[model samples]
Target: MTGEKVSFGFEDVSEEEKVSRVKGVFRSVASKYDLMNDLMSGGIHRIWKSNTIARLNPQPGELLLDCAGGTGDIARAFVAKAEEVRQRRGGEPAMAIVTDINDDMLLAGLEQRGDDGLIWACADATKLPFPDKCVDVVTISFGIRNVVDIPAALREFRRVLKPGGRFACLEFSHMATKEMQAAYDAYSFNVIPQLGKIVTGDKDSYQYLVESIRRFPKQEKFADMIKEAGFSKVSFTNYTGGVAALHTGWAI
Candidate 1:
């Protein structure tokens, strides 16, 4: 491992090592990812994602770049919402491009979604493939924490988005109440990994996932980080009493 280190869940490892380990984690869980998500979050992840899409307010003719779109949840919503707008107003439909660092995850998304008119690409979040000002919206849902360098990904989001374009992120967050936090901790540390083992036959991956959520910056801090990355109008809304959060910013 190199001297430059980063967190792979609760463990500290070299930057390269973290990337490889994270890739392995995703690859291991790719097939059962969506199912495990439903189990672990009790289907609240869907609600959180729906809240994110609503806040994004997808419109006709807009191009949405969904980075680390794993299993294509966000991209699917974006494309569908844009299509709804198009059918209602009689204009060209909006587009969504789903990019993921893990090929297995991308393949899973492809297989699950089939050809829904959403473009799929295997790409890294920190170094997005799109040209400058190429998209009207950029979103990374429940995936940014897995990035090796979140700031780099945020910068890439800014680069790809047109001025006035929006960036939205939905991810696990610290709970609002101490009582709720305690309960969440118990569930996270005890139940989620077991659920992962039962459902995906991979407990360690789920353990790492829970730990990664803890390692991620809290809601307000993440909003500031987005602003530091050159996003304006940065704001966040907590969901499910802060069990998850939706952070939004404008490229401006």
Candidate 2:
């Protein structure tokens, strides 16, 4: 894939360029990313993430590898939920490894909540640094579409999971109906970038984010991609009139 071109928010660019630009975009918005999410979705992203964690059913003593875990939202939640279960069931402690390709995002996460005892690392999704079958759960939230090689990343997610381990992803997806699609498109293409400019002073990054969501595959198609990447019993749950979705599979 050295010379291949990939979609960088509706524009065709070389893989290296896409990686560089995506890192830059995240770096630009790292400090304000969570705030932008709340503004863009009216706090609905929090619900979506909560639902995702519930469905994941994190267990005590399980290790979760949260890829592209930008601000460690999912990681913190997973560890907390698992700890809750451990307290009730009398089990070992649970842990999470929050990894991102961009250091600025990781630094932002550390600055916000570094005392949670969660491990932090810099890692590429397509080529993870962990050993095979190392983690019980793998998750990526709102970050897969920015990957230069999505299929490779999926395989890596599967690769790092132990047998019978779970994989979950939360991402922006197509709206359920044409009417809703029209309304959502008008709002997304018109308002989101301006909100980004107001909040983060970076309109282009948010524009690319919206475009990347549009470029992502539909729910069923992504489930099939997960199946093709050696996962089984793949499924997805649409959230908020399909404005976002949670996809899940098991490494078997």
In model 1, which residue pairs have backbone atoms overlapping below 3 Å? none
lDDT string, candidate 1, 67-152, tens digits: 98888888888888878988889778888898999999989988987858888898989888789999999999889989898888
What lDDT does each candidate get? 0.90, 0.94
How far residue 249's Cα lies from its native spot in candidate 2, in Å, is: 0.0
What candidate 1 gets wrong by more than 4 Å, as runs, is: 1-3
**True-structure lDDT of candidate 2:** 0.94
Best by lDDT: 2
Candidate 1: global Cα-lDDT? 0.90
The TM-score obtained by model 2 is 0.99
Cα-based TM-score, every candidate: 0.97, 0.99
Write down the TM-score for model 1: 0.97
